[model samples]
Target chain A: MSIPADLKYTKSHEWVRLEADGSVSVGISHHAQELLGDMVFVENPTVGRKLVAGEECAVVESVKAASDVYSPIAGEVVAANGDLEGAPETLNQDSYAAWMFKLKPANAADLDGLMDATAYAAHVASEAH
Target chain B: MLKQTPLNAKHHEANAKLVDFSGWEMPIHYGSQVEEHHFVRNDAGMFDVSHMLPVDIKGEGARAFLRKLVANNIDKLQTTGRALYTCMLHEGGGVVDDLIIYFMSESWFRLVVNAGCADKDLAWMEVQRDKLAPKLSITPRRDLAMIAIQGPNAAAKLWAAMPGTRELAEAMKPFHAVVVGEMFVARTGYTGEDGFEVMVPNKAAPFFWQALLEAGVKPCGLGARDTLRLEAGMNLYGQDMDEGVTPFDSGLAWTVDMSGERDFIGKDALSRLPRNRQLVGLKLLDRGVLRGHQSVFTAQGEGEITSGSFSPTLNGSIALARVPVGIKVGDTVEVDIRGKRMKAAVVKYPFVRNGKALV
Candidate 1:
């Protein structure tokens, strides 16, 4: 429900925060964590791994089920959240702060293609019905 | 639309995260399922298990009818208010459902059966009653609501919430039930903890649930119920044993009551069929979690994990697998976790009991 206006989102529930630098920090949305319940394990994409847009780059598994974390846009993974391996529940606690990985965008313009806060909120609302 | 329990609106009011469970809209959790699981393990917790069905059998021939209906020897239930856990099976020896039968009197018995299979179970019981005991009356008590209060301190906490229940239930042993007016309290639960499953009239359920919450018993959901049951090595109805699997292969042979003189519905088929598989517990030596339907490789042959999960108590994965009868305790088996063949040790279940790790 807390879709920050400064952030962008994908239909699959990944959120992206564009940094001052060229890199963008990406994590799952608050809605995503709520749906998945308590996360037990998070497998993030390795640094330097090149991913195409919408590629399944990582997996976040809860006690109930596992879900693939898809890449919002084509990019090279610059950093992986190693802290998650020890405590995956961090994503459940503060998903916006506990970014899964950093990506150097392959096409920076792809960021505009993702849903902004207003559009993403509408998308989430539509899903309820 | 999914089926709703009598307490469904109450769960929604408490902000429960609801999910579709076998066509019923049930609460998976309120917030954190792990916290709920830990709460029940450490303190008291309550679950609105009204989705489970309670059927009442009344008549002069009630005892005789149940004697031939279920696999367990209900004749053992001589004392009033005594409860027995038993399996109902098909003619092919496949499991129909597992249920708890409470003997209130010679003419009246109460059966609590799983929610998903209630309709099928009721029809089956009706057919059997017609053929075996035409005088018996079969009544489905959907008008009742069930709540399970479970944990080490559950009984005392429930007593605190509903005064006078402790004195009434204190003398009752495990698998016993006592009726206090409209409230029927039973000293039984699926969780491996000292607890009570209370059945109250449908209209009074919400008030009782609120009282329990005010008494500081955490409201747990089905997600925690599953993990706790798995850790306790209890067999889930559809997952562990279904119409495809027999009670003999599901580690429930003791409940079959084959030695009893009374002839049950599935006795002849069970006696004639040879059991080639046996259910056993597996403790994973590897790092991954074990889950249902995972293939298991043993020296004898291949088997399947019927119920598996990460044990919050053991801090590792454990499973109940149906393996070849040749396998023994302490034998090593390989489970296909992802693409890796993980080594696991076979042992007798339950992996934990009464807040202590047994294996």
Candidate 2:
């Protein structure tokens, strides 16, 4: 799958979409779901939880193993994807559309520090070795 | 380089996710691992198990040789077509590998062992054969490949795929096998369901696989195989028990026959060693997945999970753990999952059998 040129990508395989209201919608990238096949469980960050950049915030579990979903930027979670806890396979189907949580960024400048689509795609390809 | 089975091209044709399992390039799933697991429980599914090795022992002393080489007694295999599950152990009672021995005839028996331990197991068996059963012909059947058709509709699909097998296999009981032309079909399986494990010539495996697929039996892979066997309370050889643990410590005491004065390779060591840890089932009361090598805190002491996974049948996380013998069923235990202690209940396993949850 091609990386979305509009969204900012993280080295940890998360995609960040800047919303109109200054909140950021966060979800795992398509490559992440392809690596973790057949998701079974998901736990999103609770609303109102303060998250620091690089901190482990949410979790996604496949039939094989569990992985920590790290926060891409310092933020406070305003809303979480409630449907994911019961229907984790939604992430496997369309990870880009299945946002896990929405966060209000503590510092808007932090978004500039994230990787662009090209850099993130190159990073993913380099990790193949 | 990873090894490929006879059905490698077939799996690729189906667009399976090929993963490395014990150095073999095997499919983890066709599309979804969880879906394949449910297919085996509710309908028919076939698994390519050619990675496992089958050895044939043919001689006058075949039975006598096996009687001393394994932990289980073969005297119980009075019937010619009977199949016995047993553990080949080292001199110190640690398991070398667990295998199934089929009593084909008075002078012929076949043993199916694990893929990862095949080389070591064959060496051990060959050494035992040279010293004790000198005239016995021990041959590894690499010329053949194995496929296991499992689940509720497994027998029906097998019958539909192979027209002549129903007559030879209809009245066959569990733990029994029948020779049908070039195929050796056994009424046995790792999943706790009615099925057959068929051994076919390497050249015929893909055709037979296609026949079964045409008969509506879907292809399942190693990922589903692990979870299904785990839910059935079966042990994975290296994960649950190895040369470091005895059969008694790994929920396989029933396979060990101590009825008579049978001095198997590990009997003396088993008799001399102290009974310390025991295997039990654990049902997670909290959220999150249970994985192997997690620490378990009990009233007795700390133990470790041998095999753990999210059971698709149970829709809950379950595990087989080696804990202190003092811990009883209905007791509560805490599992350290990723540094967090999660509440779990101790329960008797075979968590799901015949498409039903028993825990």
Candidate 3:
């Protein structure tokens, strides 16, 4: 529910924060974590991996089911979150802070295609009904 | 349309996350399932089990009818208020349903059956009764509601909630039942913990639920129920065994009274079939949860996981799998988890009992 205005979001419930260095850090949104319940395992894309827009690059598995973490923009994975491998429940604790992986955007302009916090909030609200 | 239990409104009021389970709208969890699981393990918790159907059999021929109806021998119930866990089967030796039958008297017996298989079970019983014992009366008590109070402190808390009922319940042994006016309290539960499954009149359900809550019994959901039952190594009817699976393969051969001079519905078929597979428990040596329908590869042959879950008690993944014969304890098996073959060790089940880990 806490969709920060500075961050961009995907319809698949991932939040992308575009850093000043032009790389985008991605993690699942608070709403996504709440829906999936307690997360037990999180598999992030390896560094240097190429990803296309809407590509399934990662997986977040809870006790109930497994969910694919789709890439919001075409990019090369620069860094994967090592902390998450030890404690996957951190995503459930604070999703926005626990970024899954960092990606060097293939095209800086692709960031504009993602929805802002307000638009993403509206999207999530619409899906509820 | 899904069936709604009497506590549906109450669960909604508590902000429960509802899911459609076996054609009934039931609460899967309130907020956090893991928290609910831990609560029951350390303290007391209650479950709204009104979806489970209770049928009262009454008549002079009640005992005789049940003797012919179920796989487990009912002659063991010589004393009143004794309960027996048994599986009802079709003529083909496949399990129809697993149920708990409590003998109140020679003419009065109460049966508690799974919610999903209630209708089919009732119809099957009716057909059997018509052909076997026409004088017996089969009454489905939809007018009653059930609640399971479980955990280490569950019985004491339940006693505190309903003051006078404890003395009578305390006198009763495990797997026994005692009727206190309109409420029938059984010292039984699906969880590995010690507790009581109390059945009361439908109208008094909300009141009793509230009273138990006031007594500090946490309201647990089905999420905790699954983890607890798995830890206990109890076989879930539809998941572990069904109309297509026999007791021998489902780890319930002991429950089938084949040795006694009693002729039940599935006796002949069971006696004739060759037992090729046996159900055993698996402890995963690798990281990841073991789930149902996962293919298990053993030294003997390929097998299937019947029921699997992450054990909250052991903090590891465990499962009940039906594997080919000759796979003994301490044997290593490979499980196909999401296309990856993971190693697991086969061990004796009943993973936890009386709040202690056995395997």
lDDT values, one for every candidate: 0.90, 0.94, 0.92
Residues A51-74 of candidate 2 have per-residue lDDT tens digits of: 999999998999899999999999
Better of 1 and 3 by TM-score: 3
Q: Provide the lDDT at B208 for model 1.
A: 93
**Model 1 per-residue lDDT tens digits across residues A1-129:** 568999999999999999999898999999988888888877888999999989999888788877899999999999999999888889999998999999999989999999999999999999988
Instruction: Identify the CAPRI category of the predicted complex in candidate 2.
Output: high
- Candidate 1 lDDT, B215-306, residue by residue in tens: 89999999999988987888899999999888999999989898947888888999988899999999999766788999999999999999
> TM-scores across all candidates?
0.95, 0.98, 0.97
Q: What TM-score would you report for chain A in candidate 3?
A: 0.97
Q: Which stretches of candidate 1 lie over 4 Å from their true place?
A: none
Which pairs clash in model 2? none
Tens-place lDDT per residue, model 3, B234-307, is: 99988899999899999998899898688999999999999999999999999888889999999999999998
Query: Candidate 2 lDDT, tens digit per residue, B105-188?
Result: 989999999999999998998898899989999899988999999999999999999988999998999999989999999999
TM-score, candidate number 1: 0.95
Interface RMSD of each: 1.3, 0.7, 1.3
| Candidate no. 3 TM-score | 0.97
Error of 3 at B344 (Å): 1.2
